[model samples]
Target: MIQAKAPGKLYIAGEYAVTEPGYKSVLIAVDRFVTATIEDTDTECGSIHSKALHKDQVSFVRKEDKIVISDIDHAKQLKYITQAIEVFEQYVNSKNITLRHFNITIDSDLDDASGQKYGLGSSAAVLVSVLKALNEFYHMQLSNLYIYKLAVIANMKLQSLSSCGDIAVSVYTGWLVYSTFDHEWVKEQIITSTVDEVLIKNWPGLHIEPLQAPEHMKVLIGWTGSPASSHHLVSEVKRLKSDPNIFGHFLKSSQLNVEKLIQAFKTNHIEGVLDSIRKNREVIQYLDAFATVDIETPDLKKLCAIGEKYDGASKTSGAGGGDCGITIVKNDLNRENIYNEWSKNNIKPLRFSIYHGQ
Candidate 1:
């Protein structure tokens, strides 16, 4: 039996800029996690048990050649993990010894976190953990970096677009500066880190004080109830960036901020980290029109109203046509007050940090 776990992340800065390196995005591993456990046996077939979601009942799992969920409108949308499974089968087939008889279990706390409901790269965590476990289960000799790449390929299968940042940080286990545009540099920095120290070092999450919501902080998250189409949104943005002038400046600003954050992280300066976060927020807002759109809902409007009283800023979390709204309250005596106010209004505040994928 093999068991593995991966943590979820909260993007502290550059939420939208991640799709295109406009704002250097950072992810941190949070307390919440998504895990996979596998029990190998001599049985004839492989089966999957999804303990988190109880909606599906199947006698068997879908084959790679079968209807991949990535193709269907939505079938768990776990194509990243499924795709990795496909590649693993190919490798296993060449070896001939069947390890098919297995009971796979997956569990997650990626949804409605702290009552904040929306997807935030939960699939990325699942892909990372499963790839590592499967690699070990099959006795495939692959380095952590190599296995991480396999998960990134799985992500590509999902949307044909993937940034190695999410999964890389998940497997790397530390505070890191990652960029998909510069995969070589990202890998270099991550590989250079002593993983043993990062995992065992006692850390203070107390530095995660709430930021003041700038008055300009006009934010909202409109839930379509039906999931928004990330593929369509990604494609539209790609087309817009065809104008070199617009994207050139965008990329340049992002790359610069990334360097500043890297220096701050190296020095272990909390104030510097927060300063960089504030600056990057502006970079993300101006990167593109899709960064913040008209899909923000009325409930989101109410939350903003509450945060306004606290004197801070807010924005949507992901691809942002509509999903979860993230509110940052600047230093104030009323930070907790504002958080409590939102809760009274049925909004469960999420304590998110950039250090979440460890």
Candidate 2:
């Protein structure tokens, strides 16, 4: 059997504005992961199993160059898996390789045992893991960028509104400053070009740069019990783009703050990093007021407030209606007080560290 794992991610800055091409965001991959394992099957049909889903395995067959799940109801649940398989198979077909039946088992630690999501980019991790497993199984020796492009293609089929920073972090697996590609350009290219052609060409405005965190800085994560729908919040924020004055201001401010954060990392200025985090939080707060979408919930407010009390800079992590909020502090600060305060406020202090890629 062949196995692959992809790490979950937390956005440090640049949330809503990062959807635009050339806009940059910072994120770190966490140690929690989604893993995929592939094994050859004797039968003509292949199956997919995930403990998070149903007890029974879902069977599928390749017909007319598509992977069709046997059980229609579960098809939607397993869309990411099937989509990754189809896109990877397209690349394999380009190389004139015949496919074989295989069974895939998916395991994830991104959520609680009771199935409560921590908003850790489980979907992106799942797609990356599946593609990685398939790449290894076929001995493709594909580059990380190639795998990321394939994952993006598969992901866009399911959700077009995403910035796909999660997908990039999953594939690269470390601290990163990511800029989104031109979504409209990729959408147009998908209709006209083969997967191989698209992979070989330059994706306009997309950039991923790895960063080294300063030794004096520390990162902390707090999870609010309430789950958030990133899609809904992002969609509401997208509406603001129609009025360029409000949206443009948001984009400019977010870009400035993210650039400051990136530079702070490069210079080993821990104070500069903390200041940027605080400013980024203010930027998001301004966005919340203009968009009328509550990106930061009450619990998230409490979470950040507690972090600030301990002399750390804190802010909502992702699209943040209520999921995870990040805090950055100096090494001398005591994190236990912050964690205990979060616990007292019903916020769970997640115990994972930054995942440096294996």
Candidate 3:
């Protein structure tokens, strides 16, 4: 048997802008992970079981043309897994190798006690884990970049639109500055593209660079006690996308701040990071006004205000109607007061960092 695990991701900077090509996002790989285990089986068919997805004994078989999962319920929910297997089959077939039947087990630590997702990229983590496990199990000799691109394809197959920045951070498992692939180009090729065609294409616009948090930096994650629908919020944001003058300004400002944040990390400039985050918060606040959506809720604003009171910077982490927000402080700062204050307001601090492997 072989096992592989991948960490969930958080957006330190660049939330919405990263979706567009040429824009960058700063991402962190959190310790919470999705794990996959694979074991060869004598049966002609293969099977998958996921504890986190509440799926058991889902079966599949390889046909002359393609692999097919038998249970429709499992098939729908297991798109990433099924598509991964298909992609792996294609990869191995090109090498004139027949894949073996196996039983796969999947699990995750990205959920709460009640199984509510924490807006962490659980799907991306699971996809990365499954891809990594298969690559190791079959000795496919695939590069991490190739695995990342394949995972993005699987994710985009289900959701049509993605930056794939999450997949990059999960695969690399650390802090990174990611620029979007030419998703526009990928969308155009989908009508006549194979995995090889897509994979071989040069995405000059895509970039992923690793970085480290400044030694003086400390981050505290807080959950807003509710999960927000990222799809809905992204759709609402898209509506105003047609207004080039307004949205373009938002894009330019957001991109600049994210770049500044990266520069801050590189130079160990504490105030630069805080200032960039503050400017970023303002830009998103303008975005909420333009879209007429509550991207940053009152509770999130309260959290930021508290952080400011403690001489720190705070903002929503993702598409933020509610999921999680983070407070950035000095390493020597007192967290007890901040924790107490957040608890009183019903915000739960999530103890997480870049892939520490708990």
Candidate 4:
């Protein structure tokens, strides 16, 4: 059996901006991971088990020379798995290599005890994990960029629009500055083009660069006890972006803050980073009010206020509404107080580190 793990991710800055080409976002892969185990089997059909999805076993059989889901319920829940199988199978087949039947197991530590997702990019992590396992199992010799591209394609096939910054962070761990491919261009290619053609296509605006975090800083993640659907929030943000009046202001402010934060990271300036975070939070607040979108929920606002009381800066991490908020704490600050404050508000403080694995 071959096993692979991919870490879940959080966006530190550039939430809505990354959806557009030429804008940069800072993403960090957290400690939580989705693990996929693949093993060759002799049953002529493949089976899958997912601890996170609560499926004991689901079968996939070769039909019409294509691997497809044979279980109804698993088909709905394990779209990420089946799509990955289809994509990888197609790629390997093109090389004149016949894929063998395999049993795959997926497990994730990214969810809460009650199975609520923490908006840690579980779907992207799952895709990355499964693709990485297949890459290793088949000895595909896929480069890091190729692995990232495959995951993004699979995500686009499953979900209509995706920045894929999460996929990149999972493939290349640690802190990163990420800019997305043009969403419209990617979507158009996926709709009108074949996978092979798209694979070799030049993605003009996409960029991913590794970044180092400051040594004297600490990050705290607090889950708001409610999972926000990134799909829903992103859709609303897209609609809001059409209004030049609202989105135009948001884009400029967000880009400025992100640029400042990155510069601070380069110089190891803690205060500069914290200052930009505060300004970024203000930008989000203004956007929420101007657009009447719930980018920052009441709980998230409360979370930020708590962090402010302790001389730390905090903001909702991604496509807001709920899920987790990130707080930037200096090393000298008392983290216990921040943790307790979040606990009192029914928020769970997650113990996480930047991903250290490739």
Best by TM-score: 2
Task: Determine which window of 10 residues in candidate 4 has minimal summed lDDT.
Answer: 64-73
- Write the residue-wise lDDT of candidate 2 on 107-213 in tens digits: 89999777889999999999999999999999999999999999999999888999999999999988999999999999888889999998999999999999999
Candidate 2, residue 161: Cα displacement in angstroms equals: 0.3
The CA lDDT of each predicted structure is 0.55, 0.93, 0.84, 0.87
Task: Please provide, for model 1 over 81-141, each residue's C-alpha lDDT reduced to its tens digit, 9 standing for 90 to 100.
Answer: 5676765555455466564656667778767634333555677878877877787787876
- CA lDDT of 49 in candidate 1? 55
Q: How many backbone clashes does candidate 4 have?
A: 0
How many pairs of residues collide in model 2? 0
- After superposing candidate 4 on the true structure, give the runs of residues whose Cα lies further than 4 Å from its correct spot: 191-194
Worst 10 contiguous positions by lDDT, candidate 3: 183-192
Candidate 2 overall lDDT versus native: 0.93
Residue pairs in steric clash, candidate 4?
none
TM-score of 3: 0.96
Two-way lDDT contest, 2 vs 3, winner: 2
Q: What is the C-alpha RMSD, rounded to one decimal, of candidate 1?
A: 8.7
